[model samples]
Target: MEHHAPTTEFLGMTFNLSNVLMITIASAIVFILAVVTTRSLAMRPTGLQNFIEWVMDFVKGLIGSTMDWKTGGRFLFLGMTILMYIFVSNMLGLPFAIAIDSELWWKSPTADPTITLTLATMVVVLTHYYGIKMKGAKEYGRGFVSPLKFLFPFKIIEEFSNTLTLGLRLYGNIYAGEILLGLLAGLGGAGIAGALGAFLPMLVWQGFSIFVGTIQAFIFTMLTMVYIAHKVADDH
Candidate 1:
């Protein structure tokens, strides 16, 4: 029997329903967790406060190590929020003990180029905003002409390339992972013979995909911090 693909439409735009739902659910979970974690502040930390504090410290350390405390503290919230959102979204698609057929969603939001590109665009725009805010319009404009005014085109190209790389790197990794899983599932659908052919490879790929997902999240977060730091740093 041949299977027809499913399509979802919203606002006249078509998207894979599974991908849309998974991203929506993940975003909701992140928002709820953020609300719950920050609703109460304790003088002596416990429970959610302790967990929140630990995550803050971890992000603080990452920025502090890469940059000065003053700059790091300034962008700490942005960095932490990006890291948490991506990390949770990446892990949301992990396979569980439930039967594979029962699983409705099989890909993470970061796997979608549209979602990742939107995030990358936001980061790039924020970098420009902070750059202008910190350096003033004159100095910020001078950055394009720095070292040699003739290099302005190259600088502009570099900025565009940074945003492209930030988005594509994440989308490529997660999309490839999803493709590999789909291939494995196709093989597994062929019954006992296919299960034998697919199981070991599926196991290895799943494990490696999880690893890649985690590393991609870290890379995205780190690049975001690096971009902000470059923008806000005193030394250009």
Candidate 2:
């Protein structure tokens, strides 16, 4: 049987209860992790602090590769926050998905196209905002037609294409992973013989899902910085 996400109407708009719940949980986990990792300032880091510092360094490198540190320094926190939130969100559905009375109450938030597309839209909007802010409105507008006026249409189309690719790529990977995981779980639950048969495949697929989740998060964050760099950096 196909399970549907519970829904609620708020402010005359329908919302998916499962998406909302999982998003909140993922955000809270990321927030708590940030707090716990940075609560104590130390000259010499250890344990969680060390791990977070390394992650921060990695984010910094990602930003640096796209643009100079001078231009990308301000985005470090944003990049780190985005990377952590998406990674946490991706992992939430891996442990287990919950459904009550045929209504799903728990799953990965990014598995929903609405959530992924919203994120992509936000990133694209931020890029435009930062572009205009950094380059001035006139200069930023000129970028669409730079090198040749004929390229304007292509440039306009690129924005839409970028948004769709960024969002849909993430949704496809996560949704498919969750679906396969659920199937494996069902197979395992059938009987002792089925359980034994499904056990190894389930374990292997679960591990692979974690890897896909991590890669998806990294790709999204990296592309975000790349888009911002194109706007903010002077050399296109």
Candidate 3:
């Protein structure tokens, strides 16, 4: 089994330099695009501003469809940020960066468990915060004990499982896609004949990977909206 070596280390931790650089670069690109897009808003939007607005509206509609507008409206920023960030990050790996030798860099950040899990944890924590705020301590506590007060243990387990699944699902899909891409790249490196044989298959895989990446981003955002809605809803 040939494994690509880690790029670099920092502060006693082994960090993949390429991944870190790619994430930083992707974040900056998104930030700049966002700033440029909204800098000159118009009554009749055009160019990048129009595209950005369209995407935002699309995300808003998705949220509205899942939950009431009042609740969904409040989460517009969250949904927009997640969708744009994930979309940009997913597309970042499409043009593999070249820095050292023929080594590929700039894989999707969400494909990494560390990145996906961090985002998932934030969503889970936000859900809990809103749950406590909206329902109050008393009702929040009561929610855990509803139907069967004696099942407090099971309720706690369920809460953790929900969050775990939220993170794991995104991680699994993105990671598997990344792994398949890596495997395809490996085939391309297996001498000249292998490289020639791998081209068509590689193209197919790359196209499929793009589709998978986009769907994963949408699913993650939808789930986030659902979780937050459930937390803040009166009937939950």
Pick the lDDT winner.
2
Model 3: residues with Cα > 4 Å off, grouped in runs: 4-16, 97-105
Highest-TM-score candidate:
2
lDDT of 1 by residue, 1-236 (tens): 22222467789998766667777877788888888988898799879988888888988877876679976787888887887888778776556212234444545778778889989999999989988997788878887887798999999998899999999999898877876787787788889999999999999988998898888888998888888777767665
- Pairs of residues at least 3 apart in sequence or in different chains that clash in candidate 2: none
| Candidate 1 similarity to native, TM-score | 0.83
Provide the clash count, candidate 1. Answer: 0
TM per candidate = 0.83, 0.98, 0.86
Q: After superposition, how far is residue 205 of candidate 3 from its true place, in Å?
A: 1.0
lDDT of candidate model 2 versus the reference: 0.93
lDDT values, one for every candidate: 0.80, 0.93, 0.78
Query: Whose lDDT is higher: candidate 1's or candidate 2's?
Result: 2
lDDT tens digits, residue span 1-236, model 3: 23453567679888876668767987898889899999999999999899999989988888887778876687898898888788788777654534355444557777677777778889988988888987798877787787788889998897688778877887787777767767777778888998898888889877987887788788889888888877777665
lDDT score at residue 118, model 2, on the 0-100 scale: 98
